[model samples]
Target: MHTVAVLAFDGISPFHLSVPTLVFGRIGAGRNNGDPGGPYEVEVCAEHPGTLRTPAGFDIQVRHGLEIFETADTIVIPSWISGTGISPELHAALHRAHARGARVAGLCLGAWAVAASGLADGRELTTHWSSADALARAYPAVRVRADTLWSDLGDVITSAGVAAALDCCLHLVRHDLGSRAATDLARALVTAPHRSGSQAQYIPVAVPDAADDDPIERAMLWARTHLGDAIDLDGWAAVALMSRRTFTRHFRERTGTSPQQWLLLQRADRARLLLETTADTVDRIATDTGFGTAVSLRHHFHRILGTSPAAHRALFRREDRVG
Candidate 1:
């Protein structure tokens, strides 16, 4: 089983601390459907092996200390109360974990700690959008992607604020297990199964009430279910009972992206899942995911994910077999 160590500290947000634990800790828990459990062992560790006071004013006792990183397959810095700096001991420990081939992740402001370890130098990273500028100025060596929900570079991962932590952790599940397992976990959590890391951090306009019969949301839902079909703006507008121009404006307002861009991201994400889980040929997968042809799929897939479909499938297959 993969051993995951989540680092905690005093003054940490309780919600932030719970993100990793809630997601990874429930990996192997029994499901009602008799589905096999996940293959992860998760633990919460801290600098001191004792109670750490949270910003919520409660003390959470941690039995393991930073030394847990010595045997951890993955090390996660959930979030740091102060995004300013990292203690020397913690910094050295992080470096050591990375040197030992442990996958390290920094969620939200914890990117500062990952940067402090020097692991993010010359690498693309992201943090809460509000702090993106500060992080960039503090660590010029790291490429800060303020717009993305999260940035995953295999060994090192960082996410934007709050709920983006769920996206990042779910991504880790998908990486370690498979798309189906991730989907199952998401269903259990009552969350969207997949939200691309490339998605915008926040929408510029206020979100309409979800309970309302919002045409944009209805159109999006329809589009998701019809990704295999050749969907156009006019077709989506019809489904939403709106004119093309009106639909376009509402789509951008609600999602912070144009209809075409959002469709492309969804298609790319679907293609990735097929690539990882099925033995279908690239051309066939492309057609199934609305990419039309292998060349078109390759272009957009690489542009969005920074890797080729074949390479991604091969890597996941190899890891799945090994696991």
Candidate 2:
């Protein structure tokens, strides 16, 4: 089993701590006939083995210390206490773990600690949207992605705030375990199995004015069902009953992305689902997802997900057998 060590510190949010623990801790619990014996063994560690105060007005007793990092395959920093600096010892420990080829994850404000450890230097990182500006200002060497739900740089991963932490942890599980296992776990947890990290951090959620038909919603619904076909700005504009220019402006305002970008994202999502759940050929899957050709699919798939379709399928296949 891969050993996972979670680093806890004072003033950490209970939710942030729980996200990784719950996701990784429950790895082996099969849901929907999933294979058993999860690959991870998780332990919570601290700078000192003792009670740590939380922002929620409670103390959590941790029995393991940073020494656990030596044996861990993954070290997770759930959240950081604002204004609390990492001691030289802890910083060294983090660097040592990375040097030994252990993966490091910083969820939410925990990005601060990861950044301070210098592992995030010259890498893309993301934190809670509210603190993104501050993180960028504090660590200019790190490319701070404020809009993404998470940023995964193989060894170093960072996530946006609160519920986005769940997305990040689930992503880790998906990366290690497989889509089937991850989907089962997500169903058990009552969450979506795969929310693309590239999605906007904050989306307006007000109910559409019921009396007026929401053109964007209508257009989106139309787009979802017709992803197999070639979709363009003019087609979507016609569906929304607006001119192309008007539709483009409204699309940006409502979705925070251009029409073409949104369509690409949706197509990419469909391609990923097909790649994970089916045995379809890459060419066939590409056509099914409206990419027209395997080369086009590969281009966008790699650009958006940083992995090839074949490699992604191979990971799921490998994990399915292991699980």
Candidate 3:
């Protein structure tokens, strides 16, 4: 069996630690799957072995120490403490692991630790979108990709946040076990079968401040209410009583995204709400949300959420049924 050593630390998120375990645990001995790499073993190790406390106010028992990284075929840092200096012992272990051809993965904030190991220098990776700035600042050589859910560069891998970590591990399964097995695993886990590593992370919406006299706010409100209508940039700018260029700049400055991108996100959000609450057909929801057709809605849905509209509905609908 190929051991996959997952590095744990104090204040680790339980959810992050469990993601790889759940995904790789299913891939025991790729014999049935026709892989010659034998079984995949998941081991949770820490800098200081034993019980570790999580931010969720719970403690976990870990039996292995950093020494496991030596024999492990893959090493995963499942989220790290932001702003905390990585210990020399851990850094040396990671460097040795990478030097011996063991794949290293960082999920969410764990990317910082991977970057600190000098493994990600000049390589683009992602972490939680909120911490992208800090990751870039701390490791100037590591290119921080805030947009992607994960970046799988063979030996070195990184994922965005909690949920994206699952996707990243699934990618590993697909790489090792093949697509057919990955699809079955995803279906068993009730997740998207294959979300591309390049799929963009969902951008959090920025609500405009409610101000009666603010033209930009008013224009945004107007555009939101009239999502079914074609929202032209010039027309939207005209509603704000500003020129197109000025409106584009100000809109980006306000929301940190272009008007078109904001509008698309708004439409997708609306579609999600409708899908979750009502039994609207994909075509109807698409039309109502200004996507024009089911295909367009599915396109944007995959682009943002990395899943199809029907699949998304099934998830929420299944939850409601279970509830």
Q: TM-score, each model?
A: 0.87, 0.88, 0.62
Per-residue lDDT tens digits for candidate 1, residues 1-323, read 78899999877889998898888887855344534555778889999878888878679899999889999999989997545788899988888888899999999998888887889999889899888888888889998888888888989999987889999999999877767668878998899888878778988877677635777778888898999899988988999999999989888877767899999989988998898777999999999999999999999999987789998898789645644
Best of the two (1, 3) by lDDT: 1
How would the candidate models be sorted by TM-score, starting from the highest? 2, 1, 3
Error of 3 at 233 (Å): 22
lDDT of each: 0.86, 0.85, 0.82
The predicted structure with the larger TM-score, 1 or 3, is 1
> On lDDT, who's better, 1 or 2?
1
Taking the tens digit of each residue's C-alpha lDDT, what string does model 2 give over 128-174? Answer: 88888887888889888889898888999999888888999999887
True-structure lDDT of candidate 3:
0.82
Instruction: Report RMSD (Å) for each prediction in the order shown.
Output: 3.0, 2.7, 10.3
Highest lDDT, which number?
1
Q: Per-residue lDDT for 99-184 in model 3, tens only?
A: 89999999999988888888888888889888899889988998999888899777899999978888998878755544455667
Clashing residue pairs, backbone N/CA/C < 3 A, model 2: none
Q: Model 2 — TM-score against the truth?
A: 0.88
Name the weakest run of 10 consecutive residues (lDDT summed) in model 1.
28-37
